[model samples]
Target: MFQDISCLEEIPIPDSLQPTIFIQNSLIKLVKNECVDKFCRIILESEQYKTKIIVEKLAEELVILSQIRQNRFHLISRICQNLFSESYYKEQLRPLLLRRIFRESSYYLLLCLYNDQIYSQNDIMNLILEQKRSDFAMYFAPEFGLIDTSIMIPKQWVKKVIKHLSDYQANDWALFKEYRTLGWLPNSIVAAIKKDDLDALLDFEVDSRFNINNFIEASPLEPFRLPRVNTYMSLAAIFGSINCFKLFYQSDIPVTDRIMHSAIAGGNYEIVRICARSVCDGFEAAIEYRQNEIMDWLLQNSLCKISSAVCMDWNNLLAALYLSDKTETNEILIKGMNEIYEGKAIAMPEIVSSSSNYF
Candidate 1:
C-alpha cells in the first residue's frame, strides 16, 4: 500500500496510528500547496508519535512557500503563525528561524508578528514607527496583508499610518483627490497645518502650493498635533514660499506660508490682496507679524496699473515694493506713488509704518 501511495493524484495522510513514513516523506510537497492546514490539524490530533517534529522546520518551509506563491500565501502565513507559536511548546526549533520570519514580513505583517511576543516585539514596533508611507506599506502589505485584510489591524494603528502618509505627500504634485485616495493619508495632516511647528511647516511649505478649494474644503493631515495660533503664524510667515494666488485667496486653513506671512506683516501689498479673500482666518495674525511681503503684494498692486500690477508688472512692482537695507523705501515709495497715480488703484493706502515697528 505504501509503495503505490505516491501514485495518488492528491496524497492523503492516514493516521489511525502515529507518524506514518508516507505522510512524513510527503510533508515537503504538501506544505508547498497550503496543505498544512490539514497537516497541522493531523499533528495536533494524532497519537501517532511520542515525539512530534520541530515547528521551526515547518515554519521555514511555510515561509519559503509564501514567497513562491505570494498572492495566495495568506494561508501559509496563518499556518506559520500557528506553527511558530506552537513550536515554542517544545523549545526545540532553531533560533535563526524565528528571526528570519520577522525580517521577511512587511510593516503590517511584521507588526502582527510583534504584537504579542515580548522578545522581538519592541524591535518590530520601532521599525514600524520609523517607516514612511509608500515604502512602508508596499514593503509589508503583501506579506502581512496590511492593506488587503482590514480585519487584522486595530483602528488606532490604521489611523496613525493614514495620517503620516498624508503629511508625506503634503508637498507632492498630486491633486487633493489623488492624495486622499492613497492608503496612507490621514486626518492628522490637516490638524498639523492648523498648529504644527511653524519653522518646519514654513520650511516645508516653501515651494508647495494650496490648490484645493477654500482651505476649509481641503482635507487635513492627521496624527500631528497643533500649537498656538501665534506660534503658527510667526514662523510660517518668515519662511513660506511663493505659491499660486488662489492659495492666498483660498487659504482658510489658518496656516500661512512665509511669503504670505511677510506680505501680511508688511501691510498693503499684493500678497495681502491674494490672502485678503483667502478662506484662512488668520489675516489679522499676518498684521500682527508685520508681514512686509504680504503688505507689499497688496499695496504695490494698487500702485501699478490696477489690472497690470499683481498681474502684469508683478516682477517690476514686487521688486520696487520689496525693500532691503539698500533698496531705499522712500525711492520705491515715490516710484509706487507715481505708478499708482498713473494707474490709480481703486484706493491705495499711504505707506504704513515699518513692519518691524510692531509685531
Candidate 2:
C-alpha cells in the first residue's frame, strides 16, 4: 500500500491518525501543492515531540515553501503559535524551532511565529530597537492582522510603537494609512513631510479620522512637544513644498521671521508669498541672505519698503532701486535719501561765530 502511495493523485492522510512514513517522506512535495493544509493540520494535531522533530529538520525547506505559498505557510505559522502555547513545547520545541524561525523568516512568517510566552512582544520590540530596524517595524503589523484587524494593540503599547516608528523613515503608505485609520497619534506627520512624501500628507488630509480642527488648534509642531517649529518650517521651505507650509499657515501658527528667511533662502516663492501676507520681520535677514527674488517680491507687492537705514547699508542702493520700473521706486529712494541727509544736518553741532556775538 505504501509502495503505490506515490502513484496516487492525492494522498489521503486521515486527520484521526498520526502521519505515516509515506506522508512524512512526501511532505515537501505535498506542502508545495494542495496537501499543505491537510499536512499542517495533521502536524498541529499530533504530539509536538514527534512532529516537531520532523518539522525542525525540514525548517529551511518549510520556510522556502512558506515563501512560495504564503497562504499554506500561514497555516503552519498558526500551528507554531498553537504548539508554542503548550508549556512542554514552550520549554522544549520553542528554543529548537521557533527561535530559528524568528531569525530566518520574513515579516508575515515571523508574525505567525509570534509566541507571546517564550518571547514577549517587548522582546521582539527590543530586538528591533536594538537592531535599529524600528523604521521597518510597521511592515510586520499587517501580516499579524494588527492593521485593520479586530484585534487592538493596547493604547500604551500603541504609543510606544508609534513613538519608535515615528523616528524611523516610513515610506509605506499602507502603514501610514493604518496609522491614520487607527487614530494613532500624528507624531509621524512632520517626519513624513520632511521625507517629502506628499502622498502621505495628502492621505492625512483625506483620512476621516484626521482631526484637522484639533490639528489647527494646537501650537505649531504640537505633537513634537519641543521647540521644533523652526525645524518644522525649515523642512517645508527647503523642500519648496507650498502645501506643507499651508498646513502650518492655515493652522494659525505664527510664521516666524526665521521661517520667512528660510523660505526666501530656499527660493520657495510660494511659501514666501504665503509668509509675506503675515508679519514679515525678516526683511533684513532676507537682504543679508542676498535673496533678491524675495526682496523683489516684497518690494513689488508693497510688503516691505526700502527704509533710509536699509539704503545706507546697501552699496549703490540708488542704482538697485532704479532698475525696477515700479515708478514709485525712484520716489521712495529719493525721499529716503532726503530724510537721511536732512536728519544728518539736524543732528550736526551749530558753530556760533565770534564776530556775530561781538556785533
Candidate 3:
C-alpha cells in the first residue's frame, strides 16, 4: 500500500486510537510521497488529527516534506484555504503555521505568501512584531505597500524605521535599492524631490542619528560638506528632472566625473551634455563605459576627440567598434584602425577579425 499511495483518497481514518495511529502513519507516508493535498485532507477529516499534538506534528511534517520539491506552494495554498474556511485551525494553528513558514520556507515563500494574499497587513504586523525582527519588517515593507503610499510610509512603522536609519549605512541603501519593488524610495522621498524641498532633503541628509559614514565614504565629495549632494544629483538625473538636476548643479556640490557618468547612465542627455563640457574626462569615460548615446551627443556637441590615436589600443578600438550597431560607427573604428596601422604590416587578431561584423 505504501508503494502506491495514490489510492490514499480512498483510505479512511480508523476510529480506534491504535488504528488512528496507524492511519496517521499512513498519512505521513503520503506526505513523503508529496501527496500534500491528500495529507491536508487527512488533517481536516481524520479523528486522529483532532489531537493537537498529532495535528501539529503532521502539519510540521507537511511543511518539511513540501520543501523537498516544488510542491510547497500547493501545500501553502491548501493551508491558506483551510485557514480561511476553518475557524478552529485559524485560531489554534495560524501562529504555529506562520512561525513554521518563517523558519522553514525562507523569505521567498514569504514573498509568495504576500503575492498570494494569504496574510493581511495586520496579520503580518502581529506575526512580525511578535518576533521582534525589525529587519524582516523593513524587508517585507514593500510587499505590504507599507512604503509605497503617496504620502509616506505608515507612521506607526515609520518611527521604528527612522530610529533604525540612525545607524544606516550606504550598503543599507544599496540593499534597499536592489530590493525595492515599485520605486527607489518610499513615496515621501519622491514627493520631496518633486516639490524641490531642499530643506527637508538636507534634514534627511544630515539627520544627526544616521551613522551614514559608509555612504559618505563612497562619495568623492568632502564628507563634512554635504556628501549627499551628488547623490541628490544622481537621483534627479534618474528621474529625468532637468530642473532638479540644475538645482543640484547650482548647489555647493562639485560636479564630478562620477556624477556625469550617473547622468549618462540615466539617459539624461541634456544634463550629460552640459556636465560633459565642464567635468573632466567625461568623453573618455563615456567611450570606455560604452555610453553610446552620450558619446554620440558629445560628438554632436563637439565634445569628443576620439581619433586614430585613441583607438590604437585593442580595448579602446573594441569599445568604439562594439558600442553601437550603427554602420557609421563601424566605419569610424575601421578607419581609425587603418590610420593606426598605416606604416605597419601587423595582422589583426583572429578574434578581432571574426568580430568585425559586430561593429
Looking at candidate 3, what is the lDDT of residue 162? 55
Q: Pick the candidate with the highest lDDT.
A: 3
The residue ranges of model 3 lying beyond 4 angstroms of the native Cα positions read: 1-37, 103-105, 145-359
- Model 3, residue 44: displacement in angstroms? 1.8
C-alpha lDDT score of every prediction, in listed order: 0.36, 0.46, 0.48
lDDT of 1 by residue, 294-318 (tens): 3233343343222212221222222
Record all residue pairs in model 3 with backbone atoms less than 3 Å apart, i.e. clashing: none
Per-residue accuracy of model 2 over 88-158 as CA lDDT, tens digit each: 65566555554455455244444444532434576566555544443224545533323332233333434
Per-residue error for 70 in candidate 3, Å, reads 3.8
Ten contiguous residues minimizing lDDT sum, candidate 1: 217-226
RMSD of each: 29.7, 30.1, 23.0
Candidate number with greatest TM-score: 3
lDDT of 3 by residue, 233-331 (tens): 655554456776776677656777667756654455677766766774456545433344455556555655554223333223433443434665455
